[model samples]
Target chain A: MNNHENTAIEFNQVSRHFGEVKAVDSVDLTIQDGEFFTLLGPSGSGKTTCLRMIAGFDHPTSGQIKLHGRDVTNLPAYDREVNTVFQDYALFPHMSVGENIGYGLMIRKVPKSERNRQVRAMLELVQLPGLEHRKPSQLSGGQRQRVALARALINKPKVLLLDEPLGALDLKLRQQMQVELKSIQHEVGITFIFVTHDQEEALTMSDRIAVFDMGRIVQTGTPSELYERPRTSFVASFVGTSNILSGETAQKITGSAQNISVRPEKIRLVAPETETADSFCAADGQVTAVVYAGMITRYTVALAHGQTMIVAEQNLDDVSKSVATSRGKQVRLIWPCSANNVLQDPE
Target chain B: MHYKNNHRPKTPKGLLLSAIGVLLFLHLPFAIVMLYAFTTDETTFTFPPPGLTTKWFGVAMGRPDLWAALGLSLKVASIATVFALLLGTLAAAAVSRSKFFGRESISFLLVLPIALPGIVTGIALRSMMGLVNIPFSFWTIVIGHATFCVVVVYNNAIARFRRMGDSQIAASMDLGADGFQTFRYIVLPNLLTALVAGGMLAFALSFDEVIVTTFTAGQQSTLPIWIFSQLTRPRDRPVTNVVAFLVVTITAVPILLAHHLSQRDNL
Candidate 1:
């Protein structure tokens, strides 16, 4: 684990209130140097607000923010060592692609020749070379996103903030840019604080993910850690699909007064006559619904005495007609004890 | 491409006649003025003037009063347009970007100068000048013109600001640009064409402004004021017609140019 001095950004009890709305509640977090950290949540969940404070677009109403171990809570955006790739790209319409990319250098009084060289180099870094004089209006959506990234990365700031930078692209383009953006972060070695609401995007590229909810960070961990061992029901259901167990059914399974979650993939279906392992928890249920997704079949099973759970099975072999019609049939649902993860009831 | 007879909507004859009737009603007098500028009969409005000539053009150009009034009008219009552009853009930036107490009223006050009767505005300005004990001079004329001129630019600027949401400026700040630098590089470039359109319209409006200029211009003659004085003189009727023709062209050209520019921006 990295020490405290290696932290690139630290939010210390930061909060921003707008009259009656707490746009960002007290958020305390430390982003490691050269890490790809994501702030993931739904819209109006304060993910973007936290990113704005780090970028110095919004000052916290109370508490402090440190950049590279220095207090910069009140510093203006220009003085901060960070750049952002905006969601809409926001390229200057009046300037050519080259001028837009080199704008930061121009603002800092860099000479024209050096600025052009850096712009060309940055363009190449984003895999867009030699198409400098074209206007932003003429470019396609994906091309404009690349230009936006190149423009922010040209400055080589300590951190690159991305606010849903791939949102404007279609799904195929978004997937392609996700890979490209991850590789770019690796090459630049800059701490990147990305804000996105898409769970798939957060899972794919982030080294660490912070799930925000209603102006607060609910959980922060590596992608798999968040998925497998969520501390709360919100994190469990939000990070991935989980079958939540509550009421007396949860007490029967865990032998404690607690709620629990089990991943759909971890639950298995077996005939009642089959012998079970001692380490596994077993339940008798009838399949209520069957969902046939391409590579998997999902079963919505209702356990005896009323709790419903979802179980997913990979199509390891062809599902015969008998297996497909098991929607109304009785079955034994079994999963290893390790798969039963206890979750705290949400506050 | 020619429209197919089957696809075209048939126009009623009454509507067609009314369209031309409205066109003639609006522009016929201006056409008559242009025709009179070329007439040989200087003192009378005879049918077709018996002959067409270009002598009044030279006569109007030779007068010193024409030169002084033309120069003063140009100067006043320019100064007023500049003043309007600066204040109007700032007010627009504030109004469009921020939500504050009485924001709607601020917008209302900015536009009220042009929306109210021009004579009422003129009276208010004249009385304000009297209360402040500020002597009426060239600056007073400029202030009066700007009271209405600012609204022209303000309307254009605020519409533009609303279209360009807050994300652009956020991106600029994120790219490490200070406020002034962001305005110079991003905001100003995007705003240039709109400002040009609004500025030209303001200039056109200020150049021929009469009521406000009457209250503000103390013993000074703008081109419109000079034209008002020329109306009663029987001998200089042809020269008056020539100057009126020039005024119409001067004002109409900018408005046309403004329209063309703003239309191109939309595309």
Candidate 2:
């Protein structure tokens, strides 16, 4: 009942059940206009199901789905003013790239000349110009991904849903596409609801993200907020690597009984003689394992009170040699008390 | 030197010989049939087909009854193939694209006509026609052939539908296409090659079918039935061989073409 002018999509306690299984449990969500929002979760966490419902490919078992304040719970996908870039690309195999990109306009009864012009423009916008004559099967994986993007974008939908469209690309191509996708969203100024299981991809591109677990949104926040102040243990562990300190171990460090989470990168390695400052929390431990990644090294420290914490340190200057050789050595791990994000127990 | 050795031909001699033996066993009978179509001697079995004159081919071509039967067989196969393609594709789409009660059982029933003995299907169709007082004619023959042809197309169409997946259809809809437009643009194009291959296979199946056609066609003769009757005559033996060769060619072309189309899809 709030003003819906700026709300691109609103799910009013939506739930989708497949007979006995609750694929998407009852959830309330709102996506603002022109925001690059992401639904992030592991497989079967209902991220894709949420995107499908928004696209009208799926219907909610209960509750209402509103698009720009209009009820579209029973509207078919074609009637909705939304388009999707599917994970498999789903390019029409028989059509050339030009035809695939122009299919939407053609369906809408656009003239052939105008449709072709728009297809060309879209192809260029996706950075895949002059390859329109080739069929989808003739293109490489990355090219096909671009073609799918162009095809959906040509329709000029009010909102665009991307369901792991970059999942099929190689590492280098995927990273490149991430930056390109963010720029495209900015250029179009269209509301984007992207679904991805890769939390890093969600963090790198999305303006805001909803972390889902077990058919429910565990948390929704900006990337920095979710990374810095994860409200639940699932959110703390899923969004990024966190050293979840709780129970007696948390009491010993923070003098509090509540569960807290500290990120691996937030903890610093210091000399054993270093004293804990009033504004900082410190734990005495022995370095048990060292993992040397290219840009960073992670150390597993077994605290004296019997819990283990992982500390990630950048391989900068002499820190790399020292941390790589720190196994079996006594160390003091300290971080600002502000870094200890208190968590509510996951239900 | 090492590279050349690694690249050396590695086909085993015994395996090659056995493969050649199997190929000859399967094809040598057809080669003899071809040779006898040009045999000069009639009503006699002779080694090497004494004096291959090509006279039987001319005689076989001149028969008005043979032409009538060939024309009828082609008409029946064409109509049956069309029926099979339509019904089979619809059945395939329903089974593959929807979730409903008894979907699996429906799929199992679709292929039952091809699985059961042809004589059993023939008898069943004949009895049903009798019970309904429906006259046996060209239409009955087409219907009988379609019963099994539908299975051929369904098998091909269903396999392709499953492999092609439903994502394309969903993509089509998400791109602002209604049900008809989605099928016309997305589903139909993706399904074209499969349907063509299936239709070709169905045509071949209906062309040479004998048992079912016999029960369905009352007072009518298709090419296979004509060949069956010609086999009883001793004087027209070489002529029958010529007609059989023509039938073999006609059926083999579509079957081979369908096989080639399907094989290309794998690449």
Candidate 3:
């Protein structure tokens, strides 16, 4: 671990319960001073519950949450030094954008002249300087999102929490905002705790991601670690698409080979007639289906042991000329022994 | 099953007869009173052979008793409406949004006075005030009207609060605002329209209320009570008609305005 003393936020075994249901169970995490950390999971997976606890909207049933080494476990939301951007952008419909952005400073009892200056600067930062007079209903979805960010950032809190902030945008706009959010975080240099159910969003925007299952975190790692070295089957299936195969672990056939896992893109297909006998980790299978995407082709192959494996090949050149016709025919799959990742089965 | 497949009559003749029956059931008494108000004869109900005159309108306007009653009714309604708006909104916010023991029971009891019969509430309040040894005055009448009027405001405020998601309040609190600041900046603006609509409705209901007002109000004559007393004495019949017409205009205008404001907010 890096010996950085600048820890912005930490949760020490925090748990929350509603009636008999434990919504969040024993979560422990540390967010660095200027890092963008994401809590990624599906619905009812405790990701939002964790984010709310950090924001002080929900108090933990047990354990504690600390901000800059101060215990804020039972602080009211208004007493905490954090701000949030909601999923629907939650802009005040009655106020103009200028008023909405300046609301936090006004509540802090800052002088009007200084508040106006900071509001203008934050508006310019979001690229919405001239549109301050418009109401939230008058703006497009993306513009409203930027105003929400500006409103939360104007307070200059110790940390910022965002709850599914881009869940309402279209796919194209969501991708564009992903870049904008990351760049804005870098520019502001404040710790950000973001919650999102979209796996791709977490992978794209976060410095590190904590993957949550039902009420507990399954894994937490950097993007590359999560993709290439998943320690559990849940992480492998959740981080990205993977075709799972179940079989008894055999003796190592190659150096350092235990149980084998091959990524879909790494697997190669060869025609049955021209197949060599020395192909590495070769498996014979019948082609069940072929899906033709524009940049790649995916084949669903059924092995002799009734396990289906998916293989994807990029179309570097004309795919028709590179391989013989094998849409319905049996084929052989091969991959390097080093490409397989061994992960423990899920409980 | 046979009832489900029976041929229902779709002719305009059947619909027209039902519509006329409903109209007659609702308006027959008002039509009779209006016809009698214009008659020149000083005797019991007679349909024909009576000349019409605008002289009674002038005489009704000249009476001091009617004007006094009208003034007292306006004061009571205004005071009751303001008190109901303040207390009702606070009660709604506390009961609807907070979690504590007996919260459901408190909400249920708050609406009980309005749900029960008006006479039952009036009698109950009369005995309660007597036990406390508080004499009936203008304040008593205002309190009586406000007890029921509060239900209207509380109901409207609670519904609006529910429709507005809790995220707006959370966002405001997160943005360095204290609890009161969040209430002022975020919660109050959203609640303004609902309160105005509910206030106007409460005012209208209090203005026309006579059943409970009759028991709680010992000597003060509100417009409805004044009209009721005038119905017993024949010399004041024409003035009662004039007062009734004016009451309809006063109550209808605020209700219509409140309806328009609520519809605008919905859009």
lDDT per residue for candidate 3 within B1-267, as digits (tens), equals 243445864559889999999999998877666665676766454677278876767887789988999999999999999999999999999987888999999988988888989898889889988999889999999999999899999988988888777888888888877788888888998999999899999999999999889879887899899898888887746667767768877988989988998999887
By DockQ, highest first, what's the ranking?
Answer: 2, 1, 3
Runs in model 2 lying further than 4 Å from the true structure: A319-321, B1-10, B52-54, B123-140, B215-217
B135-196, model 2: which lDDT tens digit per residue?
Answer: 98889999999999999889999998998887898998998889999888878877888889
Each candidate: what lDDT?
A: 0.91, 0.91, 0.84
Could you tell me the lDDT of residue A100 within candidate 3? 89
Question: Which is the better candidate, 2 or 3, if ranked by lDDT?
Answer: 2
True C-alpha contacts between chains kept, each model in order: 0.88, 0.97, 0.90
- Which residue pairs in candidate 1 collide? none
Q: Between prediction 1 and prediction 2, which has the larger lDDT?
A: 2
Candidate 1 residue-wise lDDT, B1-267, digit = tens = 688999888899999999999999999999999999999997879986789989999998899998899899999999999999999999999999899999999999999989888899888899999999999999999999999999999999998888888888888887778888888888997888889999999999999999999988898999999988988888869898898998998999999999999999888
lDDT of 1 by residue, A275-343 (tens): 787899878899999988869989989999798889999989888664668978889899998998988
Candidate 1 regions exceeding 4 Å error are A1-5, A270-275, A317-329, B1-25, B127-137, B215-218
By DockQ, the better pick of 1 and 3 is: 1
Model 1 complex DockQ against the native: 0.71
lDDT of 3 by residue, A306-347 (tens): 777899999888877434465677988777655667777554
Q: What is candidate 1's CA lDDT for residue A117?
A: 96
User: Candidate 3 vs. truth: CA RMSD?
Assistant: 5.7
Q: Positional deviation of A1 in candidate 2, in angstroms?
A: 7.2
